[model samples]
Target: MKALIISDSHGWTHELKTIIDRHRNQVDVIFHCGDSELSENDEALKGVNVVRGNCDFGDDFPEELIESVGGVTFFVAHGHHYNVKMTYVPLSYRAEEHQANVTCFGHSHVATAFMENEVLYINPGSIRLPRQHPQGTYCICEYDEKEISVTFFNTHGENIPELTVAFKRK
Candidate 1:
């Protein structure tokens, strides 16, 4: 299965729409890690699995989401509640509690992906205001029975090859 993960669009609905249109057919799921700053019912988020960020005031948005796809369990959160900017420990603990195979979050605006204790953690960065990288970015993750491959792409849809990674699934 394949998934597209993005976060921190901060109200750029047009961009979100473009991204959805671009990858809708290629991915089985699309997730927004939060801070979309748009209403939960916005057309731009029609088929997306979205969580609420610190900046999001929509009561309709959930604080976290748990989804199962292609036998993989994913825990999605905005990260601010877990203090992810300083450490992943809090988030890691939560993922353990949920028995999640992967955890997706965004808050620091810095893209990163890694595996810890068999759980994959991914932050797709901010498409509106990225940090520690030249271009704002998102991520595409593909997984099968053996491994998961992740590729980061800038807002313009260009892949950032240096950020691509693959890991063995537990």
Candidate 2:
């Protein structure tokens, strides 16, 4: 299955819509890692699985989500609740509790994807307010029996090959 993972849009509904539209037919699921600043009922968020960030003021969005898809279990959160700014150890513990094979989060605005302790952790970065990279970014993940591949893309849908990574599935 293919999944589109984005985070820290902050408030750019148009950008999120454009990104989603670009991959709407290619992905099986879409996740927003929070700080969208959009109402839960907003049309842009219609089919997007989203979590609340420290900046979200509504109660509609959850703190995290646990979903099983294409044989991989995913734990998606905004990361603030798990102290992602400091370390992934806390998030790792939470993923373990949920028995997640993958963890997706945002807060650091640093895009990265890697596997550790049998769990894949992904940070799609901030699409609107990027920090580490010169351009805002997001991630797309493709999962199959042999391996899972992740690729980061800029806000304009340009692929960032330097950040692409793949891992063999166990």
Q: What is residue 115's positional error in candidate 1, in angstroms?
A: 0.4
User: Over the full model, what C-alpha lDDT does candidate 1 score relative to the true structure?
Assistant: 0.93
Supply candidate 2's per-residue lDDT for 41.
83
Off by over 4 Å in 2: none
How many angstroms is residue 56 displaced in model 2 relative to the true structure, after the best TM-score fit? 0.7
Q: What tens-digit string does per-residue lDDT give for candidate 2 at 25-93?
A: 889889999999999888778889999999888698999999888777899999998889999999999
In the range 1-170, model 1's lDDT, one tens digit per residue, is 89999999999999988988899999988999999999978999999999999999959789999999988899999999999999999999999999998899999999999999999999999999999998989999998988899999988899999988999766
- Can you tell me which runs of candidate 1 are displaced by over 4 Å? none
In order, the Cα lDDT scores of the candidates are 0.93, 0.92
Best by lDDT: 1
